[model samples]
Target chain A: MKIKVLAFGKIADILPQQEWEMDGVVTTGMLRGQLEAKYPDLKGLRYLIAVDKKIANDDSPLEDRSEVALLPPFSGG
Target chain B: MEKQTVNTEEKPSHRRKKVFVEGPISPAFVGDSIAKHSTMMNIGAHSIFLGQVRKDVIEGQEVVAIEYSAYTEMAEEKFHEIREDTFAKYPLTCMHIYHSLGKVDAGEICLFVFTSAIHRREAIDACNEVVERIKQEVPVWGKEIFDNDQYVWKENK
Candidate 1:
């Protein structure tokens, strides 16, 4: 199964812009765990995941071709 | 029941203007905005919030300055949404919001929010809410420059 991940803000700067293919990962938490293995620096950083534009939690189900955007806490005023 | 006259007079005008500018935000421009929105019969109180950059030591590193960048297209759209939402939620006479893009030195103003209302309470509450919403929704990024010319991305807590 293949899922598209879009990283933004600080996380985007850290991760390479490329899609990853997972055989059996079906949840956002599992995808995050796979990402952690590649980028250990993101271990403690707080992040928000969105399926499309709406915010999604760790337990949110992921389809084989779903689009996900990872974002950090916003800072603007 | 005693018949009471309904004063069908039109409510006063409520104007809102928001801008996202490059480089520094001119005080003259900001002052002109306030002047243009002022009226003789209404607007008894005006509240303003100015956010300035501060130089501090973070993890034993001395910070020198900051560079700000925004998804301007999206930010403008978000600003309009915030303005309309604030107007709908509160009774405000007028509002103005402006933020600086590009490099800003320490102690320089980066964000400014001003609101006018008939009373002090509405002005204060509206000002706070608008600023908070902007911080939460806008896609603006800040890069902290260290004294040694190194940089780090800033994240909101």
Candidate 2:
């Protein structure tokens, strides 16, 4: 399975690319592990995963085609 | 782009509506909205909240602009939920929430929240609640761009 990822805020700057893909990821927790492992700099940043337009829990099951976003703390009004 | 009319009939109550603008929310646009609402005789009071990007000196660097980004879909859903919650809690005649995406310079408007009601208290309370809800719940982020290209992440208080 492959998942699409979108990065925002400091997380976007740390990541090499804003939008990309990862293969063999089936859950939010796995993706987090893979991202932190591949991009060690991401480990220093605090963020959350939003899967297919909603906040995702650590063990949230993911669809192969779902869009995942790495979001830092909100600052909107 | 040509001005678009508000088509409230298009979306069902459960469906989320769009609340994003490309850059800054202009004063003329907001004024036009106010002028349009004059036709609604039932709405006696209108309270609005406008968030402007401030130029703050942080560690001797002056902030110049803010680049906003979001978990787009999730933010929309959150906005819709806030709208519904506000309506249920207050006697609002109508509500409009708009936030800026992309770069907005200091002194420009970044967020526009408008709520109309039959009384002043209801309108003011709903507007305050909606603004706070958006700042706390929405998945939108802002990058503070400072002088000479230096930047910092902005966290709303």
Candidate 3:
């Protein structure tokens, strides 16, 4: 299935594009592995995976058209 | 009566209020917001929180401003969730939250939180909780811009 990924904060600095689509990813863990492998800088960076606007664990299932975002430590307010 | 209760319980989260401002929140705006609530006669107390950007010296560099950005779609969701939770936990008459989206200079207001209730404790506690949740949960980022044109990512401590 294809999923959309959005990057924010420090993670955005490493992503080639802030928003992009990836295919053949089955779970959040797989997605993270692929991203870190592609962008070595991501390996050491701390972030959370939010699937469809909700924070998801690594084993969370990814459906087609899921909106995945990489969120670094929040510093708002 | 059953349906009405359900409606009231669910409505707060469903209503998507605008929470992001393009730049720093103005004093006049905050004043107007407080003034507008005067019409609500039942509110006896109101707690307000204003967040200001600080001019911090880092590595001999001075921070001149902070540029904020967010995963807006997710942030709105998180804000709503926080609102719903607070409303459930407190008997607040009203609540409002606003955050700056772009560059905010040192000493400028970056976030505004207001909560009103029949008494002071609920209002004060709700305002504090909302502010804390926004700092730790919302997907908003602030990039500290130094006077030398360099920048660094900010993290909640």
Candidate 4:
């Protein structure tokens, strides 16, 4: 299944926008592990995963063609 | 018999601008906005939160400035959502939020939040909510610039 990943802030700066197709991954945690594998330097970065604008935890399941956003901590005031 | 006529005239005049922006925010601009929005009849209280840059030594490096960037489309959408939510939850007359987009130096104003309401309590509560929502939802990033032209990314904690 293919998933659309939108990364913003520090994560976006490191990883460009693109689509990823995983053969067996189905959870946010799995996607995060794949991302960290691609960019080992981001291993310590803290981020939040959101599915369709609402915050999602690591165990959240992903469906085919799901829209996910990876966001770093925000500093706006 | 006498006939009478009614005269209807539409006058075109200047309207107040809602948002203001600059590379560096001027105190004069904020003062002007406060003066223009103040009135003796409707709004009774105003609450503001001003975020300023700080010079600190992090990891033995001296910090200098901050460079801010945002996903414009998404950031605006989030700002609108926060504004609508604040209005729905509180009885506020008006609110304004402005943040620096480019490079802002140390000790300079980076973010400004202003809210006005019929009473002090609502104004304070709305102001806090707006700031919290912006930090939690907005897609803005700040890069810390040090004295030696080196940089590090700053994350909200």
Considering every candidate listed, which one attains the maximal lDDT? 3
> Residue B144, candidate 1: how far off, in angstroms?
1.1
lDDT (tens digit, per residue) of candidate 4 on B1-157? 0011111121111222222244556666567657767443588999998888788789999778888876555677677777777778898877777777778888888788888888999999999988887777887878888989988778776
**Better by DockQ, candidate 3 or 2:** 3
For model 3, residues A20-54, the per-residue Cα lDDT tens digits are: 99998989999999988889999888899999999
Q: Runs in model 3 with CA error above 4 Å?
A: B1-14
Residues B66-154, model 3: lDDT tens digits: 99999998899899899989999999888888889989999999999989899999999999999999999999999999988899999
- Give per-residue CA lDDT, model 2, range A1-77, as digits (tens): 88899998888888888999878889999999999999999888778888987889999999889899888888875
**Overall lDDT per candidate, in order of appearance:** 0.73, 0.86, 0.89, 0.73
lDDT by residue for model 2 (B30-138), tens? 8887887877888899999999999999999999999888877788889999999888899888888889998999999999999889899999999999999999989
Second chain TM-score, each model:
0.82, 0.93, 0.91, 0.85
Predicted structure 3, TM vs. truth: 0.93
Model 1's i-RMS, to one decimal, reads 2.3
What lDDT tens digits, residue by residue, belong to model 1 across residues B1-157?
0111111222323433436656555566556656665443687988998887778778989777778776555567678778888888889877777787778777777887888888999999999998888888877778888988888888765
State the iRMSD of every prediction, in order shown.
2.3, 1.1, 0.4, 2.1
Candidate 2 chain A TM-score vs. reference chain A: 0.93
Candidate 4 chain B has its poorest 10 consecutive residues by lDDT at B1-10
What DockQ results do all the predictions give, each relative to the true complex? 0.43, 0.76, 0.89, 0.45
Superposed by TM-score, candidate 2 places the C-alpha of residue A20 at a distance from the truth, in angstroms, of 1.7
| lDDT, candidate 1, A1-77, per-residue tens | 77777676677778876334456668889878988998997888888776645568998999887777676776664
Q: Which one wins by TM-score: 2 or 3? A: 3
Clashing pairs in 4: none
Best by DockQ: 3
